[model samples]
Target: MDEFTSEELLEQLQQLDEQPRIEAKRASEIGKSVMQTICAFANEPGLGGGYLLLGIDEPSSVHESFTVCGVTDADTLLNTLQGNCREQFESPICVKGQVELLDGKKVIRLFVPELAPSAKPCTFKGKFDSKNKRKTGIWRRGLNGDYECSQQELEPLLLAKSGTSYEQIQLADAHWDDLDLSVIALYRTLRSKVRPYAEELQASDAEMLYALNLVRKQQDEWVPNVAGLLLMGKPLALRRLLPSVRVDYVRINGTKWVEDPEHRFATTLDLREPLLRLIPKLEATITDDLPRHFRLKEGDTQRSDEPLLPHKVIREAVVNAVMHRDYQVNQPILVVRYSNRIEIRNAGYSLKPEATLGDMGSKLRNPLIASVLYDLNFAETKGSGIRTMRRLLKQSGLAAPVFVSKVIENEFVATYLLHQLLGEEQLNWLTQFSHLHLTDDEAKALLLTREIGAIDNAGLRAITGLDTLSASQVLGRLHHQYHLIEQGGASSATYYQLAPQLQNDDQLPLFSGEAEASSEPNTSDLGTDTSDLGTDTSDLGTDTSDLNPATDTDLPEKLSQKIEQLTPKARRDKLWPVIVWLCALRPYKAEELATQLSRKETHLKHSHLNVLREQEKLIDYLYPEVINHPSQAYKTTDKGTNWLKHQGIEIE
Candidate 1:
């Protein structure tokens, strides 16, 4: 179940190529042909998937040539083959290797599956050469050795994925009127751009369509491949054949999954043009004006710029989602729009087996169809789609798109953020702090503090997936970095909070403790964490207790202005005492401070009485603790007396 054995591979190679199948080659050792055969099999859809055996040969009597001729220098051969495969293949492909016995002789089997449809005409050293004109060429698994597929054959190979066989299909019953003249004209125009000799093939729109096999004869009438209908057939013709293939756009007012949606739309049309048209519309709806600082002739100038989402990012993401999505999955491609993000989740995993978005090699499951889309400018340059999207997003002041090729679900989800990336200031801090002496888990645990506001040791363990000891080490590092302050004991009961100094500071912290950790975590993770948390509003500029408007609400209009002018207290007791005396018993929402203190919500949004209590600025700790647990209470801060004097009230 895990790998093909050499003996099994030999049995496979012995079978003739009747229909699409695979060949497994096993060897204690192998040669260059092994690599060539792998590339060849990957190029041919007709071959399905192929394999290479690593060990075992037949009995000497059964076939001397195929007998167990134990390979010399096996380890060296393995390394050489591995290097060749890595350097030569356009995208890295795997060949399963396993040690086994054939006829009591040791051997190794190497299994090579044919390239997925997403990868067409398997390439060698970055070039697609099916004809074998170049010594360095790719191939289709032939009955004997690999054979080079010619350009004429290659075109059909590409087209076959479009689910058509132009060479055998012919349009008979349909007349000239049945063909969409506008579509035919557009095809002609596009064809001329790539093929200079297109004009010489003189034929009416109907004839041309038939000649190209876009419209084939079916029961004495014209028919089309799923691709042909999608690309050129009239809208009415397409609706009849490919109804389920479509795009769904869902818009939400916030980032979470359950937020209210602004609108939704589903499109079933010529995927190419309709998608291209859809980008600008989505952009117009969600795009925002961003504030930017620039150097002008007069002085440094600050102005607002257009939305952050780039045109190229939108197009590339859309194209990738459409091209690679599993048409068979029966799920419509989703374009999820949120207030600050856009996620495109298609219905299929990566065409390249076990591949991720970071991988740049080409292995398409539907190569024939993908090739056509690229030629028509509706898709990306092969192997560069994800990379291009990353570059574009970064250049436009947004974080790079996150690509997920989930194998279990067979889906590809690309998340694009319509927000600014780490600025030069943040980048400088990150770079300066890269050499900090901290473990990965510890850094993550500390970062969680900044993100979720607070985290206990147990929370750290869950977030980092570390055992108690390991989690403790991580929390200890956070404490040493001064980015976090320990709240409880050292054991599992320990809790932590953001350090007051770094709580709202722009510069990220760097640890100067003993080095005992792995390399620094990647910036991508940092970007992800920052995007999740809206902003740094962790610190309030003032104390909490004097906020009760009723007790302090009607003292005097002029006195209120005078009290506001007084210096803020360093302790919450200054005001908490009076507010508690005024209101016998009642609870308040964190956001209720604005109404309670007779101030605007915007002004008191960041201020909290609990926070003042924690800082010990309160006059008396009525609760003896101010963690703001599920229960509610209040206290007075140190500035309460000065405030009473300003308000024309004497403090007892």
Candidate 2:
């Protein structure tokens, strides 16, 4: 682990709360929670392990700051921690511990180094659940904290231990015929254009595929692996084999998501072609739908029409989504086109940390797929895609794209606003805040939050060209001093949105009431036949009447039964799914949810509600921008619904 002093560690805890590589515990004595964190630090693949500061308490809602509650018996705590590390796991782990003085008190600083790949998956000795095959004692670090892994979540660790990737796995039912010859030929043609004498081009089909590691011999016959099927599989084969591996392009008439069944979307198209053909088709579909601007170059007689968003920027965004997406997920990539922005939501979070997204290195989840795209000049192999997009968007005078990478949710969303960062209308909006005498950068930050509904340090840095510290300070002033914005989330996941007073009437509709009052078709006109085109037209409406606190007579039977069986002593994990189900039925206030669950309101908000909404991305505030609104409540998001489906829990 990188070296750091006690002073530096304390500073991090105070400023950023908890980080991926740092944890604070008031461990007067070593316990299960501490041991789990140690295991997580050791097992996380690329974390390089983390530091645990004993005798420090995490910031709570009441505290609002980390407190240094020094250790009472440092010698005893050290002995217990060391003993547990050696004897409690499947393999012995080596750690470094030291007793240090901070604020005139004693504390223990321990660093847990990540185990080697061959010795990974450091599971507890006797914690396996026999009844459930999915339960392993393995732990991995997440954005929220350490979490136990299910069998499905353990595949990456096992693959790393065996020195292989998911792409190299040969599917049992796959055959040589699953590969498309025409796509293979297209690859050869594209490769030749890049390199006329490429050695792979000189080889036959089987030889070429073998050279690319796309095919492996299994049971005396060469068959396509996951990478091969993803790159060149026929549409029919993909539908039969990997039915969820497709792209959905949705066009909406307004600026935000619509959940009403009648007018949720304007034009919907789903494409399941192979990557080689699919990329160009997606590009064309998006480019054709974008608003155009005419430009006449010097000495040209006729004007040329170009998209408002740079074509290069759009191409890079599309290519980056497919090239870096996690194929292990059973969900489709969604490209949503709103009136003012385009959002590409993919399954995988970035392999690199969100802070260093545009840094000069590549962290590949699917190296084989990325290799092909790189060779064809479809993507940058050195992590320059984001940088390229930013540069092109700047040249076009558009607001910098905002990227939200949620690790716990296992999702990433890239939002590109279609208008200039500070256009005439935006300047007019800024006039409202001129009496406060804000700086240019501060004004830009506020305007960005108004346009996109939220802004973070990274986003502020992207638009104003400020470093991390400066951007954070600007946001700090706006949130604390001026009170123009309200902050949500913690540490690196933190974000700020317009405060309740500043969420003016000019803001666009976030739900389906006034937004759908136009001449759009009603529920009866738009039939419920969504299966024909794979379009998701289901009514995910935010109707909260059934479970209203005023009359709680109409709860779904499954939900009602689950609520009736709840106990006060139940674990938070057990309550999480139930809470999601409840919110799916209707938005619920924190106090109301607490009363239903038989927990204290303050405890529920601090322990469960805040974590679910800010950290997990499972639930979101009903009035997100106006967070302190009188009727503020929590509702389930699409990610929360997907998580429920994965857990095999169905709510009618």
Candidate 3:
């Protein structure tokens, strides 16, 4: 019974909207906004974790000028919405509906949370609605953005929600012996524990089976339901009954389409037995051994068993996928093995809203299947599988498992980082050189630059949760560490990049041997010698093609100082007019610039274009030789004349 006040909920709602993983509906309605926003947010990337504010108006205004336009029928709408949501959503949607008085007006704040990993994206109506169907469809949060689920995505996700197989139904021709006796025994053991009056009901095995709805007498013959056959039927019988409902397993070494895999296995396994077997085998492949003797004991006491994979964590993840996967979706569960990680992707999006992943509650999409698994000792009763996995991974010193629910694609993918496989060298490199001391926002900024090769301040601000000052300090640290090089200015005009010399030595040749000699006034300006890889040729492409060619002689003096002093943007902006005139004679591509200037690809992207635009020194010119619509080149602009004058260039 965690209680959040209306004010708290409003604050949370605002935070969510500011960084929503999905599309947020901008409105002030009470119940309708709550439900629709919850659904839309739930159908967002991770399924759940969203809010609906009743008082806040669209197009945010200052608080003093704000008005709280409350909902009509607040009480009645709250109850109706809660009841309807409970009935409609597969998982119990915990809603905090409250009325708050702001400026003497009553506003209802509804906080709809995301479902647990087990629960998937659920729709209110029992019809197909694609996420892109804007006017009609819905989807949960996906990694990239909101996307409509393909039929292949939707069916399995929905079927998994209830965790029931076709075998649950009583069949007309099946008998007790036709079912797997071992499976039956397991089921009985589970049922006894799950059911309260198991010992009191002194019924025979066949009678117990009948009461459980595994068997039924119809037209003078005993039959099983789809649920009965799927759960308790013999493997051969189950296959014959539902040939399409099978788990496909494929294992490959490395990550490419190339066929040079270290090992590969592909098979269609029976739902129950194969899952049980697959678990152990997957763990075996991912395991490695330590020295076996950390501390020398008297004799054999030094030996210990270490699993290659985090058994308990991976088991729960796989079990959740198997038991709760949408059985209706006939797609295969993919387990992609890579050199460093394992990706287990199942057919279904999370039913819970985005927020539930961080909370301490459970939501079951397939209560029946979950119950069956619980009895069989395959799963827990309290629904803490996700929490358990997280705890275990964290304890094992591995990165927290990444849980993602995509409603648009109708799938749930969990990534498990194999700490053992990362090796001491890789781990040392990542932890020591990875800038771990940096804040989460700072780390994110580094990652963005790493992935994209270049990043502007605005992009850094958006990705890293840093304020202006913090981001600047973080970027400065990266620059100081030689992990990143600044292109452009010290303030808003800056962009950051991985320094070429600091990058792998093998990559230095790509930027070429030509480099501008240190323009540093002395040892103080040149903080460190990064010239080990090669010479510093920062002015390789200086254009003597200035409108007043005589003014170009001054460029040599400007090139004398350290490159850091000539802010990346400033250098480009100041030289934009000269470069544009050079390009006017013969068009040059990005690669050409990089090759001619002896700068890395990263440096070119981070500094070149933005600098050209900053001083208004260049104008766009179409490439006459190319037939491309966007074919353009940079040329001298009228502003270049003034900029050259400012640089103290005299006109002849």
TM-score of each candidate structure, all chains considered together: 0.39, 0.82, 0.44
* The 10-residue segment with the lowest total lDDT in model 1: 532-541
Estimate, for each residue in 245-324, the C-alpha lDDT of model 3 and write its tens digit: 44433333333212232222221112324333434443433332111112233677554434434567766866777776
Q: Pairing residues by index, what is the TM-score of model 2?
A: 0.82
The number of residue pairs in model 2 that clash at the backbone is 0
In model 2, the worst 10-residue window by lDDT is: 509-518
Query: Which stretches of candidate 1 lie above 4 Å from their native place?
Result: 1-180, 189-203, 207-213, 233-239, 260-306, 353-361, 420-652
Error of 3 at 163 (Å): 13
Best by lDDT: 2
CA lDDT scores, all candidates in order: 0.48, 0.78, 0.48
The full ranking of all candidates by lDDT, starting with the best, is: 2, 3, 1
Question: Which candidate do you rate higher for lDDT, 1 or 2?
Answer: 2
| Model number with the top TM-score | 2
